[model samples]
Each structure stands twice: as C-alpha cells, then as structure tokens.
Target: MIEKQSLPSAPILIESIRSIGYSFETAIADLIDNSISAKATRIDILSIPNEEPYIIIFDNGNGMNKVELEEAMRLGSKNPNEVREENDLGRFGLGLKSASLSQCRNLTVVSKKDGKLSAFSWNLDYVIERNSWSILEYSEEEIMQLENIELFKDVETGTYVLLKKFDKIQASTLEINKTITEKMSSTIDHLALVFHRYLDDGVEIYVNNRKIESIDPFLTKNKATQAKRTQEIKIGESIIKVKPYILPHYNKLSEDDLKKVGGKEDLRKNQGFYIYRNKRLIIWGTWFRLSRQDELSKLARVMVEIPNSLDDVWGIDIKKSTANIPDIIKKNLYSCIEESVFTSKEVYRYRGRKENNSEKYNYVWDRIKTRDGYEYRINRDLPQIQLLSKNFDKDVLIEFERLLKNIEKSFPTNTVYLDVADGKLKNDSEMSAEEIDELIMAFEDSLNKCQELGLNVIEFYEQIIKTEPYCNNEKLKELMKEKIKKYE
Candidate 1:
C-alpha cells in the first residue's frame, strides 16, 4: 500500500493568541532585528500621521533578491540554530511575519538588490478570508513608484517595510501625539543603548527626523562613578555575562533628571536585567524572582547579555522579544542578584530621617513659682521631650498636671521600681533624684548627658509662674519654694 503525505495547512490566526497581546514596542524591536540582519548600517523609522498613521522602517543594507524575498514571507521557514556571519541578527525567521502582523493588518516589504527590485505584501484580512499563503507581487509601475520614495532615493542597496492599518497603536485622548513621541523616544533611546557599538560605527538611526542617542544604562558617562562590574558564566559553549549595577542614592538624582531615566519611579521598571539574543534585546525586566527586594528596586538597570547560540537554553520565543531564564542561569543569577541588592541598600542607607542623630532625642527643662509665693516648686526631667511651656501657660500646666497624675495612677511607684529592675527604665527615664537639691542637680546632669549624646535641648523656664503643686509637709514645701525662688 502506498501512503500520501499531507501538506502543511496555510497559516491561520491563532484565535487563542490575539495580536493585541503583543505590545507595539515588541513589534518594533522585531522589525529592527531584520534590519540588523540585512547588514543595515543606517535605519530610519518614520511615523506618518494621517487618517491611518503608518510606521516605516528603512534600512541601507544588502537588499534581498526575488527568491530571497519570497522565502522571507514564509513563516517559520528559517532554521534558528544555523550559524551565520557575526553581524547577522536573525533567529527562527518568524520575527518579520509575527512582529509586523501583530501590529497592523497590512505589511509591505520593498527591496532593491543587484540592480533588481521586488516587493511583497501580506494583508491579514485577505489571508484569513482566502485561507491561503498568497502575497501581492510588485508590478513594474509599483516598483518604480517605491524607488522614488524618499527613504530609498539615495540608497545604493536597502529594504523598506511599511506597517499600515495600525489597529494596535494605543488610543489615549490625552496628548496622544505627545504620548507617542515620548514612548518612541524612550524606546529608541533604549534600543540605541542596546546597540551602542553598532550606532557608533557610522550607522545612524533616526526617529521622526531626530537622531537617536545612546544612553548607557550604567550611567558610565559620569567619570567619577564606578564602572559596571561584569560576571560571566559558561552555559555549554556560550558565555552569558551578567553585569550588575548599583545606582547612586536617591538624593544624588535630581527630580527632573530621574524622569529622563525611563520608568525610574517604578521599582519593577527600575532594576532590569535586559536579555539579548543575537545582539538584540529580547527581554527588559527582571529575571523572574531572581531579585524582588524593595531596596534592590533602585538598581533596576542591570543587563544580561546572551549570545544567539543559547536562545534555546534561555527558552527564547519565536518573536525574539521574550524568554525564560533557564535553571542554570537562575542558579548563577541568585548570587549576583543578592550581591547587587546588598550594595544598593548600603548606598541608600541614609535615605530619610534615620540618619539624623541630633533629632534622635530632645529634652526640655522648666522651673516655675506660684503667685502666692508659698515657695512650692516643680522640676521635670525627661528624655527626648519637647517643652511646650516656658512661662508655664495655665492650659499647658493643666495638661502637664493631668498627664503626670495619669502616669502616677497607671504606673505606681512600685511599677516604676519593677521597670527599673527589669532594665526597661533605661529606655523610659533618666536618673532619679530623692531630695529637692538632688533633683535639681540630677536634672542639670541629664541635660548635660543629652548634649553629650548629641540630642536637641529646648529650655523653657523663668517665663511665667502661676500656681504651684500643694504639698502638706512644711519642710518639703520650704525646700521646693526655695529652689523655685532661686531659679525665678
């Protein structure tokens, strides 16, 4: 018996995987990968805003021939593991199709190579309706028209991709254009950072006519800052380098300045471990649970570089924009992440009032005499107290007397003795004085101790005296009155 092999079904939209789930940023990154693979020295991303604003990515590279262009349209056609030139940035070949289709319904690629030009278009709606792998071939007139397009006019050899029918662009009514510009600006800044060496080598990237600038995630531009430290581990034949970074303290960054460092406020966005495949960024967040401490959030810009060979090890997906860090990497990452967290915490240790030694304690001393001149006096000794009365206002004196009576009732003399025996008094009170002279001397000594310990002392005495605490014993009243009279 003879058996027939069935042909593969035409590609269909996986109803489970709606195109909306893929962010516009990821789609753009995927298109840029193709540009890099074509050996494009210069790339221009133009955003045309009309009824249907389209995105155009033009690159001056070794353009594709008719056959190559046809093959490129086929999804999942290229071998991901095949070795290519060092500069090639393609892997799994699905990026062009997946990335483009994920954003818009129409994707058109026009190219010129070896004096011949060709074009191809894939419309998701057309494909879904026809249920076939049909592409629009470039007619002579169409090819001629595309040649005059400004993006390709001066190019000796290159390719251009136009994404139209943008169904995926975010629609926010508040400053929509400004929002898009800011997002693209930040995305380009990051892309440039990821490919700084490439851009430095005479390759230019422009976003809406403005040149994209490279921003070092490590802030290496500051000559005084320490250089980023790198740790490398061998996963099979490929060497994965983890560059850990400790950002400057919060106070060191100015308000307007931190805003320039995209997503600086969010801890999740701040400390990042960018994953690169084939010299292109595949991931730009944390490596799962490798680092999740609140303190480590500030050091959120660390990047991890992985060669293309280890894409499988990293579980890189077809879109080349997301990946899973393997157990091998996870194990190595734990130590590197812990060390980074420790360093970041140490740097920001003095962040708030925790470092203010002077305000740690405040003491206030007040001496007052009554109008009757009965000679009764009051001496208050407390640690870290803020004195509310200097002249001893009647209302403040009443509140003080109420607080003292409450303390005496709730915490009797026996309780105080127990507290002192248990060492709790060390935290609650200063030294105790029995006789009136002794109490005065002790209060002065405690004030000196507070000063010695670098505490704030606010003295409020000899301002005003109204009534004095009544004591039955004549001897005690005389001593108190004498002390009050001396201070007054």
Candidate 2:
C-alpha cells in the first residue's frame, strides 16, 4: 500500500469553482451569511460602478486576528458536519472564498481586533502565476492603501471586504457601470428579503448609505393576515417549527403591499414553505412536492424554522439556496400543507362571496363554481335590470337577455387575472364630483321613467339604492333615500 499527495492545479480548480452557478444576488447573500455568523450588527455594502468598478462590504462584527483571517481565507476552513454555535450560519467554510472569487479576480479582507489591523488578499492572477494557493499579506503601511480599510479604524472589532477586477462581469456587458448598478439594485432586494428577519431585529444593512427595509413574506403585521396555529415536529433533541399564514385577499392588498410580497406576478410563485435556518431564510416558495402551486392556494405561506443541527437530515447544499426534505419530514408536513392550502382557498372563496351573499349590498355579479374553477356571471335578476326589462317588448326583452349573457360570456377573465396579478388593476377610489353629477342625471331619468310606467318610483329608488355602482356611492345613495322619503 502506498500514499501519494495529489494537489489540484490552482488556476484550473479556481476557474472551475468560479462557475458554481451563483447569480450576482446569491453571491452577495453568501458573503452576508459570513458577516451574520460573525455577529455583525451593522453591515454596509458599497458599490462604485465604473470602468474599474469595486465593491466593499463592511461589517461591525467580532473581527478575527491575523492567524484566524489566514485560516478563514483558506478553502474548506471548517468541517460541514461539526457542531457549531446555534447562531453560526457557516457550513462547509467555502462561502468566504467561493462566493468572493465567484464575482471578482481580487478578494481583499481587512480586519481590526484588539487595537491591531490585519489585511490579506487572494489575487487569481497571482495564484495562477505562482501555481500555488498563496495569499498576499499586507504590512500596516501597505494595508492603509486598500479601499475602505479605514472603515475598521473607528471600531474595535470589524471586517472590511473589498472586491475588484470584475473580469467576468466586464466580459458580458459593454456598459459596466449600468450593469453593476443593476446588479447592486437586485442584490439590495435579495438581502432585504433573505435577511428580513435579521433586519427586523434591529440589524442595519445599508447599500450606498441607504438603509434597506425588511420584506416580510407573510405580512404578519397586517391586520387582515390570518396566522394558523403552529405545529412542532421533534427529531431527537431538535424541533422544527411550522407556522402557516394566509395573506390578505388581493383586494385588501394595495399596490405597495403587492410589491412587498414579491409583486403581483410572483405572488403565486412565492407562496409555499419559507424555510428559515435560525431565522435566516434559506429557500422559499416551494411545497417540497407536498402540494402543488395553484391560484386557490397562492396566498398560503408556511414558515418552517429548522435549526442548523438538522442540516444533515435536510441536505442543505453549500449555497444554502436548496434543501431536500426527508420522507419522514415530508409526511409530517402534509397536514400542515393541506390546512394552509384549504384556508387560502377559503380566503379566495370568501372574497368572491363578499360580493355575492353578504347582507350589505346586492352584488350585480354572481360567482359560480364551475368544473374547472369559478366563473363570475352578471346577476340579471338585479332589481334595476329587472325593472328595465318590464319596459321592453317581448322580443326586445329576449334580445336584452341575450345581450347580458353575451357580456357575461365575453368576460375577459384571463386579462383581468393577469392585470390583478401584476398589480396593474385599476384602483377603485371614490368617484369625483363630476362623475357623481353624471350618476345623478342617470338616476333622475330612471326615476322619471318609473313614474311614467305607472311603477312605484319610491320602490324603484329602493332597489337602486341596494344595487351595484349606485350602492357603492354614499352621496348617490343619500340623494336616492331623500327622494324616497319625499314620495313617502
């Protein structure tokens, strides 16, 4: 038996790992994970886009010493299976190097601890030329030349990460500034949502000095949000907590609210298990194949909190963007998924019924459940329409009925659904005074017609007060009530 040392060629292996499928946003998030593990309270991301653009991420965390920073810069710094502090978010220890190198040719990190500053950088070109895994250590005077290294001077313990020489990004875009600006814009959104719970807990994350606000998927603070009872699944000294939430019906959600929940187009896509590892979102908008995504269940979102101890069982990948649920966990999640989906459908159904059977007003449209789904048909029997029919001759009345059905059948459900999903639906605000004036004339004409036909004008006005658009206008309803009282 014999043992031989076979080291991978530095340049080839480094270039290969650079293609690890990390999008611009995911790469930024991976670096933040390291900051969070270091117990950073405030993290600042600065991107100066230009011909020679650079990115600097500064965090006020428990900074590492010279020896510690050397080990941190090394690949495979920590074992994936080893037990760590519950708050530590690192796994595989490849995130610092892999994530940084995936975006840039030069990766420099400066840290301040115990009144001493240490700086190191891994330059891809240097590694290739040397044909070894070597990082350049900077002297105190040399370290001062690094961008944003002064950021650590004010703090006793903090780290500053600098990224430069975006060769990969420059290769794809002619307008480097515009491209990096766009990438940073999306990276802000990704951090806001992925680290939303952390942001909500007093952690400050700034991009270009602008504070980033958390985007809570469940909208738990909303008055209309329905939160189901939480269920715990215990796995040998560990607990995975599952809490379901049904977002408010779309009508109750304003356009601004839609954006917070991933925009209208993605509302359905973002509905599912929001898996969080120690309050940090790992993967989301999935049912783990426990259920399918559908219109009825679009508002259902289940928050699953699993401690990192169960990382092995969940099969959390290096990127933390994916996790596989064991069959045992999947079985336990079935009932939770079913309940959340059913409740979400009830919210949808309730919105439909709100315009149908509620005692407040007579809805002009009837929501009918079809084999495929629900259909909204005009309620031809609405009192206003019924009274108008009496004035028509037999043939004319029949044609009028056909006309209503045609309008119903020609309903642009698909277009309306898309518009609503995109948050582009027309807002139903109070009508202007000019619009109300027009309604007045139309109401007076109908009232006069009722008198001429030997019909009860007061009774006619009664039905009008309880019907569609008229019922929605308080001013019109008041005027109609006055007319009815005058007749009485």
Candidate 3:
C-alpha cells in the first residue's frame, strides 16, 4: 500500500519550472506560438529600455474573456492527450506561464475584449512569501498604469504579455538595455525562420517597430539552385513530404546571394535536413546520422514536412528544436540522401563545368567506389591521355601513369576541405591577367609534349583543348589555338 503525500511548496515548484532549460529565443518563440494560435495577424515585440528592464509582446489576436484568461493562466490548462484544432501551434498549455516566468520574476497579462479589459499577474516573490500558488489580479485602472500600456490603446481586442524584473537577462549587467537589444535581434531572426510560413501567409511580426523578414533556407528564388525530386513516405497513418534541394555552387552565387544563404556561418555547415512541422521550421542543418557532412555534399539540403499529428512519432521535444527520425522512415530518407549527395557532388567536383561543356570534356580524375572504399583514379579515357599513351614509349607511358596515380594518392583532400570550411579557398573563376598568362603557358607545355611524342599536332591540339581545365578556359583555349597556328 502507498501512502499519500502533500504537494511541493509553490515557490520550489515555480523555481523548478522556471529553470526548465529554455533559451531566451525558444521561450519567446513559445509565446509567439500562443499568438499564432489565437489567429494573430500582427505581433510586436518591445524591449523597453527603462532603468528596470522589461519586455512586452503585444499581439492583435482574438482576446480572451475573463474566464478564458483565467484558464489560460492556469498551469496545465489543456491536457496534451486531448485532440486540438488542426492549425493550433500549442500542445501543452504551459507555454504562456512557463515561458514568461522562465525569463522574468513577474509575469503580467492584460487582455481586451469587447471594450472590456482584464489583467492578471504571477509574482514569484509574492508567491514565495505567501507559500501558495497565488496570483495578483489587477483592476482595469491599474493595468492602464503599466509602463507600456499607452502603446496598446489602439487595439480593441488583443493580449499583452508583460515581463518585468528580468532576473535572467538583467542580472549582473551594467548595460542592461544593450543586452536586451541584442536579445531582441536574435528574437527577430528566430521568429523570421520559425514563423516564416505564417509571415508569407500575411502574418506580420515587428521587433521594436522594425518588420521581420523571412529567411528561406531552400533558396527557391535563386536560378542556380537545383530542385531535385520529392518523395512521399507514409509512416503508420501519417504522410511525410520530403523535398531535396541542391543549392548553387558558391561560385554561381552573387555577393548578395552568398550573404543570404551563407550568413556568418560557413555554407558547408548549412547542409543536410531542414525539419518543418506544419510549415514552421523547427530543426535544420542536421544529417540525423544518415550521412557525414563533407565538402562534396555541402550543397545538399533536404526539407522534411510533418504534420502536428506526427509529433509523437517524430519524438518532438518540449523545446520543439529537436526531432528524432523514426526507424520506419529511415530507409526512404537514406535513399533520398544518397541521390541528393550524388547530385551535390557532381556540382561540387566539376563546379558547373559539366553544365557548360557536358558533351565536350572529360575531367582529369574519376571518382571510383569499390568494396574496399572510395578512391580517385586518372581518367585514362580522355582522348589526349589515350593518344599520348599510344604514341609514347612504354617506359614513358609507365612513368606518366605512375606520376598521375601518385598525384591522385597524395591529394590533400582533408586539408582542402578544412580550408573550404574556413573560407580560405580563393575563387578559381576570377583570374587576373597574370593568371591567364599562366594558363596559356600550361596549355603550350601540353602542346609541346604531344609534339615531342610524335603525335599529329592538329589532332593533339583538338583533343587537348576538349580536356579538363583547358575546356573550362575558353579564352586560354583560343589563345593556345593562335600559338598552335604559329607552330604550323
């Protein structure tokens, strides 16, 4: 037989709830979910720079009446097991209270409906002193006296979540206003991404009077971004939509496009899956253990869409920032990942050369996969390489093949990958006049080698011009043709 025990003290429980691992961004995001669920078209986030720092999130949403406001303020007001509306962004009803108290000691809510206003507050200090789950309800006149209430006069029906005594943010800070401003900027980007679909659907969000713009991870607007095939998977009763995208090679992007997708983070780090629940981006830039992130696959990004019904199936956490891929869907996801990486690698290896000269040129190196693993070998099928092998002596051909293999074996791919990630790699497309001269010299050297091997000059010149590195430089190819005319 079990003995019944009394509940924990209100202060102790509130303290535990407030420390439940919420970053400032996610906490603010959870509150925004409430506004979105209320069908808010316009939401404003304000970080008032008073001596005592406070934050106000005001939304022009359908306001709650006195009873609904009381129910909304209560902890665990809605059971997670209960079926909610299809578009509701909330699960557990603890978001309003828990998210606000996570960052502040005092949480006050003022709501207006049909020309009547009601207010309620949860003060941790007051609850701790009283040793009970006590709430302070303010009169309409008292609510009007609040610091930011003057800004909410125009809204006839809406809700204001005012956070005061910002113990988490303002603690031990001399420049509190600057810290809040920085936090608001982060909030701006987080909301822009999380509520991007809603923003596209006419929902407006403003941070300190500045409008927030969506950051589309797919780069769908860019011409060079290749949209690959999409596959649909059914797990039990849920259907998951998967669309894979290979972003443009960095060289194909303009400076503005580079900054758009690249931002401060390396573009390589931005590869992998972007998980969305009901069109809201929850987690992104993850491979979910399907594959490793590498230089060749840096351009690959897959978008996975799941409905709220699959929350439990996907293992969505309270923070909504992480999700685990289900075993039932892993097989299909892996297949898609393989195809995406292959496409990404083609773009990465040739760097748009294949697109421009698809039928004319063959790369110097071929990527070979065997039971042993991946290896690189020189492409002996290139006409120039084959012609030289046929005309040259056996010893010379053997030496040349050995040199090619050694160069391929000793290629510092790992170091090059690190350099690419660190943004240390220079743009190969932009060639100075001196670089062009160097390219012409390399082309002339190849021509001279073919002649010394007793190959027909015209045939060798035509073959070499269509080969890798040379095929990519049309200007150098034309100049080399001029030099070959001089040889004749």
Residue 291 lDDT in model 3? 83
Q: Tens digits of per-residue lDDT for model 3 on 1-488? A: 99998888899999999987888899999989889888888999988888887889999999888888988888888987677777777877788988889989999998888887888999999999999999988987798799778756888789999998988777757788898888888888788877878888899988888899887777788977878777999877778999999888888887776775765357888889988888778888888888888776888999999988888888877667778888888889988887787668767776554567656777787767554234668898886677667778999999998998899889876566546656799867666779889878866776777778776778777777887677778787788889899768
lDDT order, best first, reads 2, 3, 1
lDDT for 33 (candidate 3): 87
Q: Estimate each model's TM-score.
A: 0.66, 0.75, 0.75
TM-score of candidate 3 versus the correct structure, residues matched by position: 0.75
Better of 1 and 3 by lDDT: 3
Give the Cα error of residue 316 in candidate 1, in Å: 0.5
Candidate 3 ranges with C-alpha deviation above 4 Å? 1-5, 352-461, 464-488
lDDT of 2 at 445: 82
Name the regions of candidate 2 deviating beyond 4 angstroms.
360-488
- Clash pairs detected, candidate 2: none
On lDDT, the candidate that comes out on top is 2
Q: For model 1, how does the per-residue alpha-carbon lDDT over 1-488 read when each residue is reduced to its tens digit? A: 89998654455442223353556666776787788778888888987665556778999988988899888987765888777566667777677877788767788898878877788988777777777777888886786675226666688789889887755454443454555566676678666766665665666788877887764555555432333468899977889888776555545665533544554565436565767665565666564776554543465456688787776787777666568877877888767765565545444543442355333322232212233111212235332133333335889888987886565446343454345435576552222235545645544554455456554433322211111211223444454455455334
lDDT of 3: 0.82
* TM-score of model number 2: 0.75
